[model samples]
Target: MILVTGATGHLGRAVLDTLLQHTAAHQLAALVRDPAKATDLQARGVSLRVGSYTDPASLAAAMPGIDTVLLISGGGDDDGLQQHQNVIDAARQAGVRRVAYTSRALQDPGTLANELMVRHFQTEDYLKASGLGYILFRNILYMDTLPLFTGPTVLETGINLPGGEGQVSYALRSEMGEAIANVLLQDFTDSRIYHFTGAAAYSFHDVAAALALASGRPVVYHDVAPEVLAARMRERGVPEVAIGRTIGFMTDIKHGQESLVSSDLAAALGRQPTGLLEGIKQLYQL
Candidate 1:
């Protein structure tokens, strides 16, 4: 059976939902820290295995009898790499055959700016050295997060960032989930890596133009220095560490680490992925 960890999370839930359409619930198991959060999945007849990434014993219990395991990266906090290490060790001990991981899309994984991406890089290295067959999903920034960079009222505050002229191959989280499910449903046995990014790359200016067109309002793109962006985030009550991390991502983009576009996502979905303007409309309800 295929076991999906983080079954209650946004991406994990989407993957399970897509899997239900392609495979029976009997062939699947969901590992979640809180079984109560997985009631909907359990109702669909999927086996619920209580597990925590911090608890190796629980992860070991969850991995037995599973042929394929999707180890969704842990929370955005600093402890995520440690949690992933625990999961990896347990999966190996439990005799899981195939493992898949979600990693970030970056031109240089060694960049020190974004701690989140750094941890993903570290986890990828760990997974590679584990002697197990693995698949790496190098996912780009989510288009859904575009709405977050813009203020509550997108049209009013427009989009502000430290990204300058940098471009991002932003893909929708839903389509990414679909692509991952498609990968797992196939006869994928060998270790392979796929860049799960949008079919096209768009600059912040292009995103602003798309938003303006979608909202029928002039939404300008404001490019500021990293420190200015950090100050803005701080003024909005974002935590210091989070603000630093956000700035780090922008720094990575500014250094041209996020501009790569790939056809792998389209091939995985068997169709064209959503474009910037349409995705903006869907996200903003415009």
Candidate 2:
């Protein structure tokens, strides 16, 4: 049977939706922290396995009879690296044939020194040393997160950020989920890493142009200094931690860390990935 962790999350739900199209629900299991939240999945015949990455015993109990496990990265309050190690160790002990992990896409791992990226690198290292067959999906920034970075009134106020002119090859989260599901359904005798990204890289200026075309308005991109952006966010009462993360992400982009364009996503989907303008129109409904 195939097992998916974080099954109630957006990416997990998307993966499960696609998996159900071509596979039997009885052949799948969902690892969830709360069984109460997975009633829909249970009703659909998928076995619910109550577990957390932080809890090794729960993970071990969830792995019996499962051949493959997709380890969706944990978020918020969890020590992500330790959590990943726990899952990896449990899967290894359970004799799962292979394990898949969702990681970020970075062209220069040495340069992208953010806390999150560091943890991903560390996790990858740990997983590699576990002696289990693995699939690493190094995903790009999600097109779905454009609004969060650009703000709600971007069309009215313009796109203002500290990203400079660096470009990002962003893909839709749902599409990435679909690609991941497609990979999981295939044979896993060979270990692999797939850089899931768009066909082209786009900058904040490109985003502005796309917005302008979609909205039929004169949207613009303002490349402000990082300190300036931080001050503006502080004025809006954004938490200091959030502000730091935003700056770090923008800085990484500015240094071309997220600019790598790859066809892995399209190859997995068997079609060209979505473009920036189309994604913008779809996201903003304009």
- lDDT (C-alpha, whole model) for all candidates: 0.88, 0.92
Q: Largest lDDT belongs to which candidate?
A: 2
Tens digits of per-residue lDDT for model 2, 82-199: 9999999999999999989999998888877466677777888888999999999999989998999999899899999999999999999989999999999997599999999999
Model 1 vs. true fold: TM:
0.97
After superposition of all CA atoms, the RMSD between model 2 and the true structure is 1.1
Error of 1 at 203 (Å): 0.9
Worst 10 residues of 2 by lDDT: 112-121
Stretches off by above 4 angstroms in model 2 are 76-78
TM-score of each: 0.97, 0.97
TM-score of 2: 0.97
Measured with C-alpha atoms, the lDDT of residue 91 in candidate 2 is 96
Tens-place lDDT per residue, model 1, 1-286, is 8999999999999899999999999999999989999999999989999989988889888987998999998877668899998988888888888789999888987665776678888899999999888999999999988877766865887777898888999999999999999999998679999999998889889998998888788988888888888887888899998888788878887788888898999999999999998898899888
